[model samples]
Target chain A: MSKQSLGSLLIGMLIGVAVGVYLGWVQFPVEYTNSSMQALAPRYQDEYTVMVSEGFLVDRDINAALQRLAVLGKENTPDYVQDLTERYISQSNFPAIPSMVALSEAMGRLTPLMEVYRLPPAPTPTPFPAQ
Target chain B: MARSPRARNGIRWLALLIGLVLGIGAGLLYTWEIDPVIELNTAPWQLNPAARENYVIAIALSYARNQDLTLAFDRLRAVAPDRNVWQLVADIACERHRSIQIASNSDIIVMRALEQLYRSQGATGCADGQYPTPAPIVFMTPTPTSTPIVPVGPQATKTPTPDLPTPTVPPPVATTPPTSDRFILARVQSFCDAQLDGVIEVRVFDARGQGLRGVPVQISWGGGQREQFYTGLKPGREPGYADFLMERGRSYQVSVPGLVSEPRSIEAIPCEAQRDGQTVTVTTSYWINFQQQAN
Candidate 1:
C-alpha cells in the first residue's frame, strides 16, 4: 500500500514477466512429431490406407502394397482395413467399391459384391505390305 | 517508511513472489493459446503423415484427369523432399486398395493413374497385376478390295523392229537420304544441363557432328502435350538445332516419329556434373541431340 511497496512490486513484476517469457518460448518449446506417414495417428491411419490403396490400383503390385501397410502396426492393421471397407460400403463409393471389396476379400473379411474383369484381347493385326 | 525493517523485507519478498507467478501465467497463456507458433502455408513435406497421404491422393487424382506429369512431379517432390516419391505414392495407393478402403471409381482410376505415373518414371511397386492400361484407341481405315477385271480386247501382235534402240539409254544415279531428315534418338537426356536449361534441344546433326540448321523436330509428351520446333531458329546456333522448353521436373519422351525406336521414353534425370565444368541446373536448358549418317 505504501510508495516503497508499490515500487518494489512493479520492478518485481517486470523481472518475473521476462523470466516467464524466456522459459515458455525459449527453454521448453513445443516439439512436433508425426511428420511422416509412419508416425501417423489413429485418426489419420485410415485415410493413409486409402491413399495407399489408390497407389496399389496404379501399380497393381500386391507385394509392395502389403509391405507398405505393414507399417500400420501388426495389431491394428486388420481392424483398420475392415473399418475403411465398411465406411466405403456405407458411402457407396462406386469407383473404389470393387477394389475395396477385392481388398476386403484379401483381408479375409468380406466377399466382393461384384466381379470385374479385364478387357478382352483385340483381333490379330493384318500385316502391312512393305513399301 | 513507518513499517519495521523485518516487516518491509517480508512484504518485498511477497511482492516478488506474486509478480513471478503472474508473469509466468501471462507468458504461458500468450504463447500457448493466443499467439502460438503457426505454420502458415505448410509445404507438403512439412505436413503430418496423414495429411501428406491426403496430398498424395489429391496429386494422383489430378494426374488422372489432367495427366500433367511435370506438375504432379513438382507437387510430389514437395511432399516427399527425400527418397523416391513415386514409389511412396505407389506403395500408399496399393496399401489402401489392399486394405479395402478404396471403393469408388475415382479411387480406382487414381490408383491406376498413380501406378502409371510412377512406373513410367522407373519406380516399381507391389500392385503389379490386372490394372493394365486400356488399349489405345486407333481408327484403322480399311482399303476396299476390288476384283481384277480380265482384259477382254484382242491382243495386237508386237513388231520385232523396236528391240534395236532400247539398249542405248543411260542408267539414273541413286538419290541419298538427306542428312537433316535422318536424326536418330542416339542421346536423348534430360538434366539440369546449363546448356539445355530445361528445354528440349532437338539437335539435328550428321555423322560428322556438324549441327544442321532448319531441321524441323516435333517434341511430344503424349496426352496431346506436343509441340514443334526447328533448328537454326536461333540464327547463330547450328541450323539443325532447335529447342523446346519443358516445364521443370517432368518425365518427357521425345520421338522423331519414324526415327525413334518403339517403347522408348526418357526423363531428364537430375545430374551433378557434365563434360567440362558446365553443370546441370534447374533453369539451364538441355539438348537431346539426334545424329544421322550423311547420305
Candidate 2:
C-alpha cells in the first residue's frame, strides 16, 4: 500500500467518527421528559385522546370530557375532535366515534360530518307524583 | 528485530487513537439503538404534557367515586413517577382553572377532582374554590327521651285481711326490636341496570314497586361514619329513593329511622360485566328497599 493511500484511509476514518458522534449526540438526543400534554408527540397525543374518551364513558360528563381535552392545546378543540373523529371513521374505528361526537356536541361544535355517529339523547326524568 | 524508539512510539500512538475511535463508535451504537433507555416504565415527570393530564384526570375520577385518597395517590405517583404527586395535581388544576377556558363539565369535574385530591393531601391550589366537594354526610344517633310516671297503687292502708292483694303487673309494653319486619321490611336486590350510581341506594315503597316519599334513612359505616339522609327529596332521583356513595372494601349498615325494619349490611365490592360483547367495569352496591307494612 502507498503512504498516501494509508493517510487517506486514516483521514476518512477521522471524518466518519466526527460525523457519527455529531449526529448521534447533537442532532438527535434521547428525550426522557415531557411536562405537558401539548408537548406530547403526535402518537402519544392520540393515545391520550382515546383514554379521555374512555373516561367520559365511565363518568358520562360531556363538560369534563371537553376540559380534559383542553390539554391538547388546540385553538378550537371541537374542530380538532371532529377532524379526529373523521379520521377514526375512515380508519374503521367505530367505537371511538360516538364519544368524540358526544364531546363535540357538548362543545356546540357538532358538524354534519359527525351526524352519522351522534349519540342518542338522554332520557328525561318523569316528575314524581306530588305527595 | 530492534526498531527505532521514535518509530515504535509513533506506531503506539496511532494504535491508541484507532482504539479510541472504535471504542467510542461501538458505545454510541449500543446506547442509541440496541439498549437505548427503555421508555416503557415512564415516570410521570417523563410523560408528555397531554398524557400526564389525562392520567391525572383518571386519578381524580377514581378518587371521586371511591373517595380513597391512598389509591388515588398511588395512581398519581405512577404517572408523576414519584414526585410530590398531590402537589403536582393541585398545580395542574390551578393552572387549568386560571386559563379561563370552558371545555365542558368534564373539565370542571377534573379540576374539582384535582382540588379534592390535592386537598386530601394538604395541598392548596387555584382551583380550591372552583370545585368544592360536599362534605361526607354525618348522622347522629337520636337519643330517646321518656317522661317519668309515678306508679299508682291502692292506698297504703294496712291490709286488714290476710287475702293477698291482687297484684297488677303492667302489661308488657311491646318494645320493638332493632331488627324486625313489622313497620318496614328492607331487602337489597341488584340488577345490572340500576339506573343510578350509588353505593347504598335506599328505596321506600309499599307492596308495589312504586316509590314512597319522605322516608328517613340512616347509613352507618366503618370509622363511625354515619349519615342520615331522606328518600324522595333529591328531585331528580326516582321517587322513594335516596343514595350515598360508599368506599370499596368497607361495610355499611342501613336502616330506616323510627321503623321496625331489619338492618341490612353490605360490603362494597368491585364488579365487572359484559354488555353486547364489551366488558364494562362496575362496582357492587347495596340496594336496601323499605316496604312499609300496611297501616
Candidate 3:
C-alpha cells in the first residue's frame, strides 16, 4: 500500500477507536426505579394497618393517638402494631409526627411488645423512632 | 531516487495519531481522577435535590421509628450536602409522609403536639435556665370519723381551765413572684418565601419579658412538611430570634416545648432597604408570646 494510503487508514482506525471508547465509557443510563424502599413482608401486615389507623387519628387528635399507643405499650401489643405504625408513617397520616427523640421513646416502649408478639425488626431502625 | 509522497504522508499521520492519543488521555484523566474526587468529597448538604430528597426520605423513615432528632439530623445532613437543615427537614417530612405537610395550616398540628409534650413535662418556661414554678399538689381531703369521747373528756375539761395561749399561724409565703406566672412562648415568625430563599425564624421569650436561651424550637408549616429550627439566646441575623428569610404572604407558626401558652401564627410582609442607589425589599414575619409558667 502507498504510504499516504496507509497513513489515512491508520488515522481513520484511531478516530473510530476513540469514538467507540468514549461512547462506551462516558455514557450513563438514567435509573428510573425507586429502589430505596423495600417491599413490605406479610408478617407485618397487621402492624402496617394499625400504623395507618393511628396516622389518621394523628390528623385529628395527636394526643389521643399517643395515649392510645402508650396504653397499647403497657399491654401485650400485637405483631401488627409495627406494620400499622409503618403504614401510617408511609401514608403521612400524622400532621405533626413527634420528633425523632419522642418517636424513639415511643418505639423503645413498643420494641419489647413487638418482641413478645414475634414481629421482625423494621427494615431501617436507626433513623426511625430509635435514633 | 524519488521518494514516494505517500511515504512522507505516513510520517505526518504518525505524529497526528500521537497527538490525538495524548488529548484523549488528558480528557479521561480530568474526568475520572479529578472530577470524581471533587464530587465524592462534596458535603452531604450540598447534594442535588433528587439525591437530597432520597436521603431525607430515608432518614425520615428511620427517624419516624427512632425519634432521635440529633441522629436523624446528622444522617440527613450527610445525605443532603448543600441545603439548610430546617429546609431539609421540611422537605423530608413532606416527601416521606403525607401527614407531615409543610404548608401554613399544618403548623397548628405541630404546635399542638409540642404544647402537649411541654405541658406533660411541666416545663415552666422555654428559658434555657432553671426557674421556680408551682407544681401541682395532690392533697387528700380529711375523712370525717365518728368516735365516742366518753367520761374522759369531762375529767380533762375540769383540769384544763388554766389560760391557753392564743394559736398563731404564719401566712403562707410566696415562693415565686407574680411575674413568674408568665410562660415563655415561641412561634414561627415566617417561612418559605421564594424571595427570601426559603428560610424560617422562631422567637422565644419568658412571661417576665426576658429572652430565653438554649430552648429547642421547631416550626412546622406546609402539609407534609417536617422542618425544625432550634432557638438560642444569642442574637443574630438568621432564623431564630434575630432575623429570617421568608416568602411574602406565607403563613407559619412556632412551637417551644413547655412554653407557648397557645399556638401562634404569623404572615410575612416585605421589608424595604436601600443599597447602591437601589431599593431592596425583603419579606419578614414572626410568632411571639410569653412562656406559660408551670401552675
Candidate 4:
C-alpha cells in the first residue's frame, strides 16, 4: 500500500490500456465471417445489382428479379434499380446498361435516359404478297 | 554488509502485473463490446450462408448470359478462395433441389443456371439433371414482299375463284434433340493401377466426341444391388467422366440408362501393380466409354 507501488501500478495500467487499444483497433481488428448481403460494400453492392440485372435479362421475370434485389435491404427496390440504371447510363457502363435498363423497364422504373438502352423488340415476319 | 536504505524499497512487481492484466481486460472489454469495429468493406467470402447462396446464384446466371467462364471463375474464387468453386456451385444446386426451391419458373431457371455452370466445369451432385435446360428461342421472320398488281380485266376472272387456305407459320419448338436410347457404348478398356483399385471409370461423350455432362450411369452387382450416378461429379476429371468401385472377385455390369448397346460386364480380378516404390496386389480396373449415336 505504498505510494510508489500505487504509482507503478497506475503507470503499468495506463501502458496496458494503450497497448490493448492498439491491438484491438489496429493489429487484430475483429473480422466478420458471416455478413448479410446488405453489409456488402458499395462497389460490391453495385456489382451484385448488375448481376441481378443480368439475371433478369436471362429469366425475364421482373418479380423474381425484385425478390432477389430485396436482399440488398434497399428502401425501394424499383427506385433503386432505376437510380442504378440511370447512374450506369451516366457512367456509360455499356455492358451492364442494357440489362439494367431492361430490369428497370420491367419494374416500371424506366426513365427517359434509359429509352435508348432498352432491348430492341423482337423482329416480326413481313407478310409476302401472292406472286 | 551495510546497504543503502533505498535498496530495501523494491518495486511491487506483482501489483503492477496485476494492474496491467486488469487494464488489458478492461480495454478489451471496451473495444470489443462497447464500440466494436464498424462492419464495412466485407469481402464476398465473409457473406453468410444465405447471402453467399444468392451471390452464387447471381454468378451462375451471369455466366449463363455471358458465357464468360474466366470471369465467372474469378468471381467465384473471390467468394470461395480455398475450395473448388464448381463443387461449391453443385452443392448449392443440390441444396436447392433438396429444399424444393423450384416452385417458380425463375427458381427453375436458377437451378438450370447452377447446373449449367457446375456441369460445364465437371462438378456434379444429387441435383444433376433434375431440371432440364430449356431450348433457346429462335424467331423465324418472313421477308416482306411487294403486293402483285392484278389487272381488273372482266374476262380474266369472271368466275369466282375457289378460296385458297391461308398459310400459317408453324409454332416454335425446342431445338434440343430427343433424349431416348441415343447412346451406344463405344469402347471398354481394362487397366490396373495401384492408385485406383477395382474402379469402373465411365466416360460419356456426344456424337462429336465432346464430353457430355449430367448423364446418369448405373451399375448393378449380385443380389440385385444397384446404384445410379451421374457424370461430371469430379471437377478434376472430364465432364463426361464418372467412376464406381467394385469389390475384388465380384462381377458388375455397367450401363447408361436408355443405352442402345448391351450393358458391359466385367470382373474385378486381382492384379499386381506398383505402389510407393513397392510392388503390391490390386484389383483390376476398367474404363467404359459411351458415345451418343448419330441421329
Candidate 5:
C-alpha cells in the first residue's frame, strides 16, 4: 500500500471510532432492569423505611420490621430507622411521624424529638384495693 | 505492476468499511461490558425479582395501615404499570406460599396483607384463604364480684356508749350491666355502579357506631354454599368492612355472630347504569350493615 492510502485508512478509522463511541454512550446507554434495593435512590429509600415503620405499627413486630428494612442492605438497620425518624422529625414530615416514632421506640431508637409523637398506651383498669 | 484505478477504489472502500465495523464493535464492548451505565436512581419497576417482591410487600402493608387504595394503586403502578396491580399482588402471595416463605409470623402477616390487597380487589390465586387473619385480641376489664370484707378490730379504748352508733351500711353501689355482644341487622341498601358490580359489602359496628374488626361474617348461597371471612382483613377499607362478589341470578344470605335479626338476603339482579355517557347493564350490589344492640 502507498503512504497516502495508509494515511487515509488511519483517518477514516479514527473518525469511525468517534462516531461509534458517541452512539454507544450517548444515544443509547445501558438500562438496568434488575437491581437490588440498595440501588434505590435516596427518596425511595426513605419511603421504604417509612413503609416498614408503618408495618411495624400494624404487627408490632420489631424483628419483622428489622428484617424488612434489611433489604436496603444497610449495615445497621436500627440505626438507619433511628436516623430516618430523626430526619423526618427535623423535616416535620407529620404524616409519617407517628409510625416512625412507634417503630423507633420498638427498636429502642426513640430520641427526645420522637418522644412527643409516641402513641399513647391502651388504657387498663385500675386494680381494686386488696381485700 | 500498476493497480487499476477501479481496483484501487474498491480496496479503499473495503478498508473504510472494515474500519467502521471494528470501531463499532469496540465501542459496544466498552459501553456494554466495561463501563455500563452507573446503577443509580433505579425505579421500583427496575428492581430484581426479590427486591420487587419486597417492594410489593411494603406497598401492601402500607395500604393496610393507610387504607388509601388510590395511593396504593399509584405506588403499585410504579412497580408494574403495564400489568394488573391486584393480580401482581396475588401472584406475589402465591409465590410466597409456594416457596415456603411463611415460616415466620411476619411472613404469614405478609401473606395475609398480600391476600387482603388482592382479594378485596377481585383478584384470586392459589394463596387465597391460605393464611387466615387471626382475630384481634380482646382484653376484658376485670369486674368486682362482691364487696370487700372488712374485719372488725378491737378499739384502742373501749367506751360503751349508752346507744351504739347504728351499724352503718355502705349505700348500695349501683353497677351498670355489661353490654351484650349481640348484633342486629341495622340496614340493607342496594345500589348499582358500572364500576362496582355484584358486590355484597358487609359492615359491623359496635353500639357506639364505631366499626368493629375481626367479626366473622358468614355468607350462604345456592345449594347450601357457605364461606366465612373476617373483617379487618382488608385494612385498606374500614376495619369492619368485608365484601364478596355475587354471581348473577344468585341470592345470598349474610349473618354475623349474635345477630338478632334473621339473616339478610340479597339478589344479584341485572340493573341498568350509566358509564362514560353510555348506558350499561350491571348486576346489582348491596351494602348490609350490622350494629350491636345497646342493652
Candidate 6:
C-alpha cells in the first residue's frame, strides 16, 4: 500500500485497540467478571456437580454412589464440596437414606486417606455395624 | 502555519473534553446502580455499624409498642437482611429489659399485664409461661392479748397460808402485737426438684390485707444473655401472676408500685416432689407495707 494509506491504517488500529481495552477493563467489567455461574470456577462447579450427583445415586444404591464419589475425590477438592455434601445429607429423607452401617463402611474406606490429607472425615450417621 | 497550530490545539482540547465526560458518567453509574446491587447481595449481619444500630433500635421500638411482630421482623430483615430473626429478637429483648423490679402489688399487676401482652404477641424469653399455680394469699394478723386480771380474793387466802410453803407465780411476759402485716407471695407444700416449666402464681395485697388487682409486676432472669421481662398480672389470676420457667441458680426480682416498701428478690430453689410432677423450684417473694408515722 502507499505510505499515506499505511499510516492512516496504523492510526485507526491503535484507536480501536485503545477503545476495546477500555470497554473490557472498565465499561462492562461486571458482565465479564461474572461469566456464567457454572464457569465462574471450574473446580468448585465440577466438585459440587459430582457430589450432588453421587448423593442422589447413593439414595438409590449405596455402592454405586460410593464409587462415583471416590472418582470425584480423586480429581480435586472444590471450595464448596463440604457444603454441598452437608446440604445433600440434610435434604435427604432420614429414613429413606442409606443405612448408617453401609454409609459408615463407605466412609471408613476414605477416612485414612482423608486423615492423611488433614481433612475431616465424612459425617457418619449413628448405628454402625460391629468392626 | 497559523491554521495548523490552531487545529492541533483544538484536537487536544477535544480529547480532554471526552475524557471528562466519560469519567463523570462512570462515577454516576457506580454510585447509583452498581454499589446498591452489590450491597443487596451482602448479608444483614455484615451491615455497617451505624446501619446495624438503627436496625436494633427498630426492633426495640417494635417490641416495646407491641406492634405486629411479623411485620417488625420483616423490617428487621430489610435492615439487616442476613441475620436469623428469632435469634436476633432473643438477643435484643434480653439486652434491653433484663432487670425488672417487683417491689409492690402494683408493680406485680403491671408486670403481669405486660407479660400477657407479650404472650398475646407470641414473644418468648426468660419470662415465658413457666410458673406453678399461685397459692392463696395468707394474711398474718397479730393475735391481741388481754390485760391480766388482778386476783384479789385468792391472793388474800394465800397470804394467810404463808406459814405453809408460798407458791411463787412468774410474771406474764410482756406481749405486743406485731405492727406490720405479712402476706404470702407463693407457697409450695412440696418443692420442685428440677427445672419447673410453667407459670408462677403471685398474689399481691395491700397492707390492709385487701387483694390488689391490676398491679404491674416485672419478672426477669438470665436468658439470651441480656433481656428484661415485664408483664402485668392477668384479671382471673389476681392479685397478679407472672409466668416464668424456674431454672436452678437463676434469681427473679419482683417490684410493685406504691406498695413496695422495699425491693424484693427471690431465688428459685428446687422443692420436694408432688403428684403429677407439680412442684415449686423457686418461691419468689416480695412485700408492701404502710409507711410508719415519724415519732
Which is the better candidate, 1 or 3, if ranked by DockQ? 1
* Tens digit of per-residue lDDT, candidate 4, span A74-105: 99988888898898889998999999998888
Fraction of true contacts retained by every candidate, in order, equals 0.35, 0.16, 0.04, 0.66, 0.55, 0.00
Query: Model 1 interface RMSD, in angstroms?
Result: 7.9
Q: Please give, for residues A19-129, the per-residue lDDT of candidate 2 as tens digits.
A: 556655666556578656665556556645665665665467766667777876889877777778778878878856786677667767778878888878765668999
Question: Which regions of candidate 6 are displaced past 4 Å?
Answer: A1-16, A26-28, A32-111, A114-131, B1-6, B9-295
Q: lDDT tens digits, residues B1-295, model 3? A: 7765535634556545654665555545544544422222233344445544533433433333333445554664555445455454543434434444334322343333222323222222232122223343545546989887765543444455678898998676455445443444422233323344334544454432244566665555566454555556445522225334445566666566664356666666666645566766666544353344533
State the lDDT of candidate 6 residue by residue for A12-109, as single tens digits. 44555455445544565433222222222333333224323323322333443343344333443332333444443466533212322233334443
Listed for every candidate in order, the interface RMSD values in angstroms are 7.9, 6.7, 10.6, 1.5, 2.5, 15.7
The residue-by-residue lDDT of candidate 1 on B1-295, one tens digit each, is 5867634654576666777778777777776666655433234576676667666875675455434556677778877879778788878767776777655554566566666556444345666433655544655556899989978798878877755655675565334434444445545444565455566666665443345576667666747787666678886654666777766466566656446334246555455556476653355445565655334
How do the residues B1-295 of candidate 4 rate in per-residue lDDT, one tens digit apiece? 7644543445467667777887787777777777678988888999999999999999998977775566888889989999989899999999999988889989998998898777654567999888875554665567899999997766664688799998997786655565445777766768889999999988887643457899999899988999999999887987889999999998999988768778878999999999989999999999787767645
Q: Assign candidate 3 its CAPRI class.
A: incorrect
Model 5's lDDT to the true fold?
Answer: 0.82
What lDDT tens digits, residue by residue, belong to model 5 across residues B45-156?
8999999999999998887687555677888998998898889999999998998988877787788778867765556789977887654455555696998887878767
**TM-score (chain B) of candidate 2:** 0.40
Residue pair clashes in candidate 4:
none
Q: Tell me how much of the true interface, by contacts, candidate 4 captures.
A: 0.66
Candidate 1 Cα misplacement greater than 4 A, ranges: A1-38, A41-44, A55-64, A111-131, B1-78, B81-295
Q: Across residues B1-295, which tens digit of lDDT does each residue of candidate 6 receive?
A: 4644413533443344444455555544554455522322333344454334333443433232332345445655654466554445544443434555444443333234334323332345664432222454555555999989976664443445346677898675434324333332322212233344333444443322234455555555656342333334454542433444545557655444443244454566544544456763443322222121111
Please name the candidate that would achieve the greatest TM-score relative to the true structure. 4
For model 1, report DockQ: 0.16
Q: Model 5, which residues run further than 4 Å from truth?
A: A122-131, B1-13, B135-295
Best by lDDT: 4
After the best TM-score superposition of candidate 5, give how far the Cα of residue B101 lies from its true spot, in angstroms. Answer: 1.7
TM-score of 6: 0.22
DockQ of 2: 0.08
